[model samples]
Target: MSREPTRAAILIRESRKRAGLTQQALAEKLGITTSAVCNYESGASFPKAEMVFGLCDILDLTPRDLFECE
Candidate 1:
């Protein structure tokens, strides 16, 4: 993967941290594998479109933080 992190990945990682959650904890809550959480945080892959909204709620991030705003 590229060295640069995706904006959404960075935001996810930051928000998870801000929420005081570990990768495993977040994965458990999201019903995903810890490795999958790692991939998302590392920007190895992107979360699905439907998942973004769930992530925003779980991580307490605004959609504007994970995505572009007009």
Candidate 2:
């Protein structure tokens, strides 16, 4: 596996922080479990396409933001 972080993980973490949202809070907003949020942030799992849009809306990020690597 690659050692580098996934863009989804980085974007989710940074955007969540910037929005002052905890995993629980974000999960609540998305109607998902906190563990799901954690998985996404840790790159252990990825959201579905529809969920991606939902996350972007809730986290104030664009689709590009989640795919862009720094």
Candidate 3:
């Protein structure tokens, strides 16, 4: 079955590409390993609420933008 993309997944990808950041680079910014970033992009895991703030800060986005569920 096909799965719809979650907002977190979409935001992770869009922000990374817009910033010209490789997965490794984004992981470094978030103080995580590249595998974590890869998982986030692949929709295998979700960031915690606190981590969401950090992600927004790093990606230059607001929580609303990242978590929008429509």
Residue 45 displacement (Å), model 2? 0.7
Per residue, candidate 2 scores C-alpha lDDT tens digits across 1-70 of 7455587798899999999999999999999999999889888888887898999998888877876743
Instruction: Give the whole-model CA lDDT for all candidates, comma-separated.
Output: 0.82, 0.86, 0.82
* Candidate 1 Cα outliers beyond 4 Å, as residue runs: none
Better-scoring candidate (lDDT), 2 or 3? 2
- Every model's Cα RMSD, please? 2.3, 2.5, 2.0
Model 1, 1-70: lDDT tens per residue? 3666687788788889999999999999888899988998888887877877788899877777777721
Candidate 1: the clashing residue pairs are none
Off by over 4 Å in 3: 1-4
TM-score of 1: 0.84
Clashes of each: 0, 0, 0
